[model samples]
Target: RIERLEEEKKTISDDIKDVFAEAKGTGFDTKAMRSIIRLRKKDQAERQEEESILDLYKAALGMV
Candidate 1:
């Protein structure tokens, strides 16, 4: 079962590679785009956590 899952994962991964190749053919930098996407998600999550903490602090101070 594990072997089958691994094979499926490889197949899916290859399909993704093919898609990325096509994207690159269209002049897209897949690697940089992926990095940007990861960074954006990380930054967004951090900002969200910061906002949540600020909200909690305001509530604690009876300002919210």
Candidate 2:
């Protein structure tokens, strides 16, 4: 069962790579898309707090 599940995981991962490749071919920014996906996985308040801290750090470094 464990080995079968591992194979399934690899297949799903490969499928994800294929989809990202297709998106890239269509002019989508896969790196930004990955970041968006990561942010979407977080709760809204958590995401907002992270962004707020990032903005604060950027401003401190004059990156804003």
Candidate 3:
């Protein structure tokens, strides 16, 4: 059972890689797409907190 599940997991991971490749071929920014996917998984409050901290760090580094 565990081996079968692991194989399925590997297949899903490969499919995800293929999707990202296709997006890249279509002229999409895969890195930014990945970041958007990650942010979408978070709750609004969590995203807001993270954005606020990022803004603060950028300001400290004079990148703001």
Candidate 4:
């Protein structure tokens, strides 16, 4: 059962890869898309806090 579940997970992962490939073929940026997806997974407050921290760090390093 565990092995079968692992195979199924791999299949789903492959399907995700195919979808990303198709999106890239259609002129979509998969790297940015992945980042957007990750951000969407976080709540507004959490995202805001992360961004604020990043901004502060960048400013500290004169990267802002």
How would you encode candidate 2's per-residue C-alpha lDDT over 2-56 as one tens digit per residue?
9999999999999999999999999999999999999999999999999999999
Scored by Cα lDDT, where does model 2 land? 0.99
Tell me the deviation in Å of residue 30 in model 4.
Answer: 0.7
- Tens-place lDDT per residue, model 3, 1-64, is 9999999999999999999999999999999999999999999999999999999999999998
lDDT to native, each model:
0.89, 0.99, 0.99, 0.99
lDDT of 1 by residue, 18-63 (tens): 9889999999999998876666777777878977998999999999
| Candidate whose TM-score is highest | 2
1-64, model 4: which lDDT tens digit per residue? 9999999999999999999999999999999999999999999999999999999999999996
lDDT, residue 12, candidate 2: 100
Candidate 3 similarity to native, TM-score: 0.94
Show where candidate 4 strays beyond 4 Å. Answer: none
Tell me which residue pairs clash in candidate 3: none
Candidate 1, residue 40: lDDT: 78
Q: What is the Cα-based lDDT of residue 48 in candidate 1?
A: 81
Residue 2 of model 1 has an lDDT of: 100
Q: Between which residue pairs do clashes occur in model 2?
A: none
Give the residue spans of candidate 3 off by over 4 A: none
